[model samples]
Target: MDLDVFVAAHQAEWARLEQLLGRGRRLTGAEADELVALYQRTATHLSLVQSSTPDPMLTGRLTQLVARARATVTGTRRSGWRDAARFFTSGFPAAVYLTRRWWIPTALISTAVGVLVGWWIATHPEIQNAIGAPEDLKAMTKPGGGYETYYSSHPAASFAAQVWTNNAQAAAICLVLGGFLGLPVLYILWQNMLNLGVGIGLMSSADRLDVFLGLILPHGLLELTAVFVAAGTGLRLGWTVIDPGHRTRRVALAEQGRAALGMAIGLAAVLFLSGLIEGFVTPSGLPTWARITIGVAAEAAFLLYVYVLGGRAARAGDVGDVERADQTATLPTAA
Candidate 1:
């Protein structure tokens, strides 16, 4: 292939792209259409030259031209509020709904493990002794004890912030490290459930289980669900890397990774709500049933959002990835 011939052939198109880019702020319909077409073609040309040519100056020049053309064609993006609105109304829920098969089962299995462990700890005094001294256990499970007092230990605002930060970090880890064969996600989930089980067991053994549930259920429902979503999505990502079906592994990973990242952001908001509930509603003087009802309502609302809004978007072909125009892609080296 003659680089000189290739450059000569495309020089005219590149010049046209530059001309359109240099035009006035608003474009005519025809000019707008032409700009898009030229941008795509120029991008492809850049790709080809980068792979096939040895001229650094030529490559650099094309790169600059393409970058400028992209800015002119796309213009500035919508505001942050618009992005947030779109995420909750469409992207976040769609991603959650899409991964329902993975996370729903995860919720069930995790709950089961927690229940089983709680039962084991409740019924086995020897196990309770192994966990802590009888007096220490008594101190924790007695009325107005460690379990009940912990929520009120700090100022509500500070506690809410702390919980939000901690939960968000946990969710981030689950989503980000999912590609490590999902083992880390599993470990994190297991450790979480184990702690819950031990807490339930010790509290139940002392007949303070009701108090624990009253406090926990108000925030745990949504908090746990968000965690489960993160873990399940992470596991799915790992599985995709292991078996990407018809798509190339890289493509599959890219798709799922983007979805997982969207979930991470979405879950941050969800966790924030749970943190509010934990710091305010959970420790409030409200009746136990009322607190639990608030938690249940929040959980139900999230589920409805996923099933209705998310399911609709997904069924209509949204995969929760960043908009295609915004997505970065590596040009195939052979293309």
Candidate 2:
């Protein structure tokens, strides 16, 4: 790896590649072939210099030449509608489906927590008393009272938008902060389940648990699923920090982070649908059975989307990451 000797050998090829690149779209067939050949040789030369007896000045010059040649060899890539289509149908859903082992358990465990909290609050007069006076509880949980009326207090359209915004923010927080070893994500989940448990506990104490279910079931099914997905994904991100498996920590994080970001965008759309159900269907004049059915249908559709479409995409090697060409290049490290 004599640096001077190597530079002397390949300097002319590097210069020729640069001149061909400067010609832009005017390269003849023979010249284009020559350009491609020169580009390959220069790239190898750059790699050799970088890996052994590196010279900063020589490295910088060769790096620039290789990058220019690469761009000319492979035209620039731009994202278009096809990319968006692939994302929703393949990338986003596939990422979610792949994380099923993590999130499915998350959903089950969190649900149990909510139910246990509700049961504890319902049966314990001491806890209820600590929360508020009997009169206040009655005011809040009675039929057509605070719990039921809250959904309709605001106009339906505005309420839907507000719900969407809040849920999106919550999901985004889980995804972004999950990299903190998942502690913050866990606390956020606790707070959410606690709120739900209080509502259930108060309503059950008033002998209006059925009424509460009727109101919540119309949207809770899907809304909670999205939350669970975000939480699970965040936990996975944190776990990567602990055990990146075979990949380097930085590489694993980059891959997971990108997937989580795409998941956030996808979950926003899911939450938006649930928000619609909460704002309009939850408080509408429709029969309880009908509204709940609509909620169930929407939830079923989402599950199908994740399992069928996402499963297929994941099997085909889609990890919900941006296409390879879109990713930044990373040099290999010697162990």
Candidate 3:
């Protein structure tokens, strides 16, 4: 059959099927059977039409039909409860995928580099001197000396502003670099890890490791973990473009981009909160045990939400499932 004729036939059938579906009434067995047969035929025709010469008008019409069909299947409006539940559920799968698939590996690799380089630099007094002379080393080695002194001198507003600006810049770098094939993203990750290692090494040298831990661990755990998550998202996004894995590049990019964006947004929010904590709470002379306890508890809460709460939420209203239908029915519809 001619391509135009084939598309026309399918388009007519697709429109009719859409109308039937849109009626929003239960279909009789015969009507449902007929609709299913028509759907299958239309799908076959669409495949053929796609492979043949493309018509802009037909393609547009088909796109519209498909979008309408999707809306009908997914529902036109979502409740706030459903939205919150979905956000929670979607987060864990992304976190799990990131941790096992990318974050943990990247962190391990980066940490290894940081430890090796940091250890060498710490042990070699000459290199340390080059980075900062022996006289000035006190400032470098001490936690509440250089940057901390600057921070302490600044007004509360200025300090808060600096923290927010710095953290936002870091998050933006992680997100934007993901589009550049992940090399830039990896570089950002490495730089962060390197800085952290050097900071710890310097503190160890000054015999103020406990002070550093009390100051940074309070918020560093959340802040650093969020960065790792952001970097993982970027890595996955870059990999999707480079290696599409059985799907077309465009399709894979779309799918991976959605997942990556979700993770990136979640991480950004986390980093923002971490920055607030670091700026306001960390600088205070909180006890080491208190800092450790807060850090551990914060991590525990995050883990529970991601692994348990999030998982349950995602499965809560899965499309086409009985649970979803029951939940939807319980929601009050507009009169």
Candidate 1, 191-304: lDDT as tens digits: 999999999999999888888999899999999999999999999998998998776677789889988988999999999999999999998999999999999999999999
- Residue-wise lDDT of candidate 2 within 94-196, one digit each (tens)? 9999999989999999999999999999999999999999899989997779998999999999999999999999999999999999988899899889999
- The lDDT per prediction is 0.91, 0.91, 0.64
Model 2 stretches astray by more than 4 angstroms: 1-25, 28-31, 34-69, 330-335
TM-score winner, 1 or 3: 1
In the range 1-335, model 3's lDDT, one tens digit per residue, is: 58656655555788777777777678788877766766556555554555565567765665456545545545576457875565546653434444445776776787788677767766777767777777687965565586456435666556766776777677667766686798888788778877877766676677776766677777777777677767776787788778977766765666566556556556666666676667666665667688667777776666676656555545553211123332211212233
Off by over 4 Å in 1: 1-38, 46-65, 329-335
Index of the highest-TM-score prediction: 2
Supply the global lDDT for candidate 3.
0.64
Q: Which rank order by lDDT, best down to worst?
A: 2, 1, 3
* Superposed Cα RMSD, model 1: 4.0
Q: Pairs clashing in candidate 2? A: none
Report the number of clashing residue pairs per model: 0, 0, 0
